[model samples]
Target: MTAITADAIAFRAARDHLLTHRGDPAKVGASFRWPRLTQFNWALDHFDRLAREDGDAPALWIVNEGAGEQKISYARMAARSNQVANWLRGLGVRRGDRMLLMLGNEVALWETMLAAFKLGAVVIPASALLTPADLRDRIERGHVRHVVAGEAHAPKFESVAGDYTRIVVGAAQPGWTAFDASRAGSDAFTPDGPTQATDPLLLYFTSGTTSKPKLVLHTHQSYPVGHLSTMFWIGLKPGDIHMNISSPGWAKHAWSCFFAPWNAGACIFMHNVARFAAPSLLETMARCQVNTLCAPPTVWRMLIQEDLAAWRGKLALREVIGAGEPLNPEIIEQVKTSWGLTLRDGYGQTETTAIIGNAPGLPVKPGSMGLPMPGYRIALLDAEGREADEGEVCLKLDDVPGEAPGGHPGTGRPLGLMAGYEDSPERTAEVMHGGYYRTGDVAQRDAQGYYTFVGRADDVFKASDYRISPFELESALIEHAAVVEVAVVPSPDPVRLAVPKAFIILTQGSAADRTMALDVLAFARQALAPYKRVRRIEFVTELPKTISGKIRRVELRQLEISRRERGTRDAGEYFEEDFPDLKS
Candidate 1:
């Protein structure tokens, strides 16, 4: 056995402090401290130690319908990951090498992540849904040396044409190594040397909600240890079954699935289906006794479309959370009404862990994403870089004494922040400038410290003299019975300079004609203020979205601009002037 390291001790002390004072917010904020570690290997020090202690306790539970369920214990996970690490080492997977993991929600996905950590190899998470072009970009730009994916996704890489090592999970692919071979390898692994706390560990590609994706970098202590705040936010406890509905590639998947839940010694419950049927998923959670859940807003919206009352009281959820995007107040209210549990909203980005979230015992305001979590100092900076009630949400890095209100926070960076954008210092400097990490997303902090989300910096527009927020308008539009999904963009106007226009998806088997548009426009008019009312409505079969499910408003805006430039009108567009019935 190895002697207990200083890094492990510090990590444990910080985690224990949060657990102890999980109730008193003031006490936690005043006394809590971010751990300062010189050397750390989370896979070796934390996960392995817990595995040895927890023994047969469930660490990962995957629910599969016809294939039966797979329940892996902590001890088995440690052994399996150790075997994978040894096999990877034998195949020339060295420290600092980048390995892209593209697989479904399977045991091998978790196994490969732990193995990469043990081997000191940097991991780049990739969704299996990537196209051939995306794969080429990841391989060339990410500098991938190895790829671990399911055999089904192997064909997509055939045309990618890289000099990387190919390893398949299910079956032996043509000219690829089989991951099953690792089972016969040694189950005991050893590190070559000590790992620095700041060593690169993960490289994530942002979901590109408004623009092209950027590579986000994290270190050994950033995500795995930094998610203590996320653990604190979720109020995760030992023996709890946390079911987080996130895809494998995104950063949220690692935030909740790999680190936060495991840090609390809770079992990660994952459900896999060929097609997502929320009713069936609710039944699984009910039957298996899920203790907590964190799902994206889109999933929550879809779940509510069904008969939510049928499985209302049957759920075993103690904590329900909304993640990924800013959730509408309507969704939160509907869930609260049905399940008798407040669906709390959490705000964060790929650059950091839970910077601000609604921790337990905090007063949650409707349409607000709660307060700044422990270890985070939030400042809303306006266009002039001055603090404001509503502005770009920036994190205070250091505290400059005798300075102004928006002065630098401090010298040392928080443990939760990413190292920087990989190989893109210019882009890194842009966001990390002025002693603050600009989150790009904006919000408004109330007098009581509750923060309500505004639209993204690039998504907010102006109509007449008043500033317009697409999120606020869309939030109100979704409350209408005929609306399924909607995206608000600015339409060029000579009078108001611009007016709010909507690209809407109606309910299934519903009309998209003048009557449907007028009904939606009337409902929105009643809900929103005069200046904020949607002036034009256009029916669309589908809204353009990033693979992560965020609406591509930038594209929608450009489309409108081009249409006006070419002097062409969309046949689907319905203006308020044409619908005299909606004129009030």
Candidate 2:
């Protein structure tokens, strides 16, 4: 198929179809088709056309910290991006060149991204939170040919050596070119060549939660087209203002904050801040008329700490969703009660877009991560690879026999799936075996097909011949007023072979002393099953987390193993010999 057909196949015209059916999976899946084209560029095709026709319409709305807000029209954005594309092309940026975009959620960030897409350049978006070491890894591993960053961040890359072209967005440096100069260039964007649907568009060096970060490669169609499910999941409507609480350079950032919302012709709202302040975010949301909102569980957790009812914005806001981590049912309920809004939960990864999500109008099953999106055939596979009611979540590519409807057909396979990790074919093969992509997460499905997340494949352990899910135990523990955040890991025990242990982070008013620990322990005993009781307890000040805000259970597991090896014992560790007060 030609590149235009590929582009058309990628964007499958699901907006109208999805809206008509609205969360009706059977109809949506049957109707959805990836947008197919012979020669197409989103920036040149969709973005520019939207700008030309809807020039007065607001495309981006950014609120700076307490100072003021700036709104840019779709027309301005189209022209600006075209100028940047032309300027970058003049600076040796070619169709296949890789560039690192390290900047805040500024206008230029979006502009550069659109420009990069137009140029068919592979953009590796880097967060300002990344250290020099992280930058080094991305620079060396990503094969970046150009670097686009704010002037303030230039010093961060000062020591990192690369032959890539440097383009600064804010202020001009001695060696870097100012992004402002792009305005002098022509608004007419003339692509040197067509961008194939298989063309590499973006590279993401993921924030490694389990292992070293892998460079996640996305095709021109992967994210831009894949996020249609995300658009449906969030229930974003045309002319709506959507604000997603995500830091720049992350996959989730792009998921809700960019393509998904834009695909529906919604205004993308950004509230730039150094740290998360609950009241401030709410205030901004209200002030800016945010119609739909998406945030990770971390931000949602912090938001719940404050009185949620105190702030109600004037926006015709309808949808709110949570990702990043599993949404605690309690948090979801709290938000629902306070805001009269239900928090939808979605599950996906850096490798793909939102696959399973509680789409709008779907009856959310409390803690369940809703049904699979239309065009996705999600299956629970047992250890032997046969279908099961509860096991690993795997996609049945064979059953589909092809990509989902509206999925790339002659375009070859699914459009939403990744192009594989750059230079890591072995790892790619591991996950994409048996014509199925194993999610590595285990889950149980009900008769109705609603799936509930069990835990990471490695996080699940057995004790006393009873399989245990850490999430279940942790959920039960957090119900106690004293517990703020908790992690459950297996502690070696000679009696049961292994036992559940609680690593607790107490609430603000809760103490870390023995009294508080005992209180939490007692609460856990009452809340959890007898077999899954916390046999040991540790009061930790904070839990180790990946940059993405996921708790590093692997690190916690290592700590437990190290403690076992050192033979340094703690009070909560159950020991028959030491516990003279306990009767056998």
Candidate 3:
């Protein structure tokens, strides 16, 4: 058994503090202090310790649709990762080397992540969906030294030029090392040296929603220890089966799948399918008796379309959460009505861990993401950087003690925040200046301290001198039965200068014709105020989305602007004026 270090003890103490005060956010916020450690390697100090104590306990459980299931115990996982680390070291892997890891939700993904951490190698997680062009950009800009990918993704590198080492996870490919060969290596491994708390560990490429993807760098202490707050927000407990629906390569995957549940001594559960089917997913969760579940709003929206009440009786779910986007109030209400559980919403960015969330045991306001999590001091700042009721969401960077909402004393810098954008100091400075890290997202805080998301700073526009939030209009549009997905953008108008126009994807079997458009427009007229109503509708097969599944409103806005300049209208577009019988 590995001897636990003092740093690991401090980390555990902080984690246990949150577990003890799990039900009281106010108490946790006021008292919790992030452990100050100069030398710490979470995989070695913390995870290994857990493995030593609970060797027989299950650490990872993955279920495939027709392929059956795989359960790995803590002891087995630790030894496998140790052997992989030793094998990789023999292949010239060392501390600080950047390795690009692109694989699906298979066992190799977990084994490689742990092994990379143990070997002190920096991992740049890439989605298997990445194209050759995407891989080329990541390799050049990320300064990658090694590549470890699944066999299916190996052919993509044929067109990508790089000098990095190539290793494949499945059946051997020519010119690529077979990952299976690592089994011959010994299961006892040792680190080259002590890893500093601030040493670089993971480099994530942000899903390019508005512009090019930026490389966001995280330290060993930032994500590994920073996710203690994430565990608290999800209300995880020892032996609980926690499942987070997120694709690998994104930061949220690391937030829940890798760090958060492990921090709480919970089993990480995954259900892999060829494609997402709401009915099958719900059934699996019920069969597996998953205790806590966290999914993006997109998945939640799809799940609500199925008969939720029928499955509620068979499920053992205790906590449900929505993330990746602002959840609609209608979905929350429906879930409560059907399952008797509050669908909590959490807010964060690729740049940080879960900063604000409707935590367990806290009163959830329908449309609001809840108060700041422990160790975070949230401040809404206007354009001039002054505190405001509605403005850009920002985090205090200074260590000066201040009072947060509910009279909780604000701590210093949160360990969850990223180190900075790699190789882009000016970009980093722009967001980290003014004694705060600006999130670029705007929100309004209520008097009672809950915060409701408005929209992206750039997505908010003006119509007839009134400021408009596209998210508000989009949320309202989503409530319609025929609307499967929607992105609201400001369309150029001769009279109002700009009006809210919706790019909509209709539900299956719904017609994209005049009758449907008029029906949706009438529904919007009754549901929203005159200024906030969706004035124009365009029925489309699909809306533009980022690779990570976020709606690309910026692209839609640009499309509208280009159409206006061209003096043309889309084939499926309908104006409010066309619906003469509909009342505004």
Best by lDDT: 3
TM-score of 3: 0.98
The whole-model C-alpha lDDT of candidate 3 against the native structure comes to 0.90
Report the Cα lDDT for candidate 2: 0.80
Q: lDDT for each of the candidates? A: 0.88, 0.80, 0.90
lDDT of 2 by residue, 359-396 (tens): 88888887799888765678788999998998998875
As for candidate 3, its clashing pairs are none
Per-residue alpha-carbon lDDT of candidate 1 for residues 36-58, written as tens digits (9 for 90 to 100): 88899999999998888886889
If ranked by TM-score, best first, what sequence of candidates would result? 3, 1, 2
Over 1-584, each residue of candidate 3 has an lDDT whose tens digit, in order, gives 56678888899999999998976565678888888888899888888788988988889999999999999988888999999999999999999999999999988899989999998899999998899999999999999999999999999999999899999999999999999999998999889999999999999999868889999999999999989889999999988899999989888899899899999888999999999999899889988999899998889889989999998789999999998889988899999999999999989988899899888999999888899999898999988889999999999987664655323345567889999999799999999987799999999999988889999999999998788998888888899998888899999888889999999999899999999999999999988998888889899998888889888998988999999999988899999999778765
After TM-score superposition, what is the CA distance of residue 479 in candidate 3 from its true location, in Å?
Answer: 1.0
Span of 10 residues, lowest total lDDT, candidate 3? 401-410
lDDT of 1 at 374: 78
Q: TM-score per candidate, in order? A: 0.96, 0.93, 0.98
After superposition of all CA atoms, the RMSD between model 3 and the true structure is 2.1
- Cα distance off (Å), candidate 1, residue 30: 2.3
RMSD list, candidates in order: 2.4, 3.2, 2.1
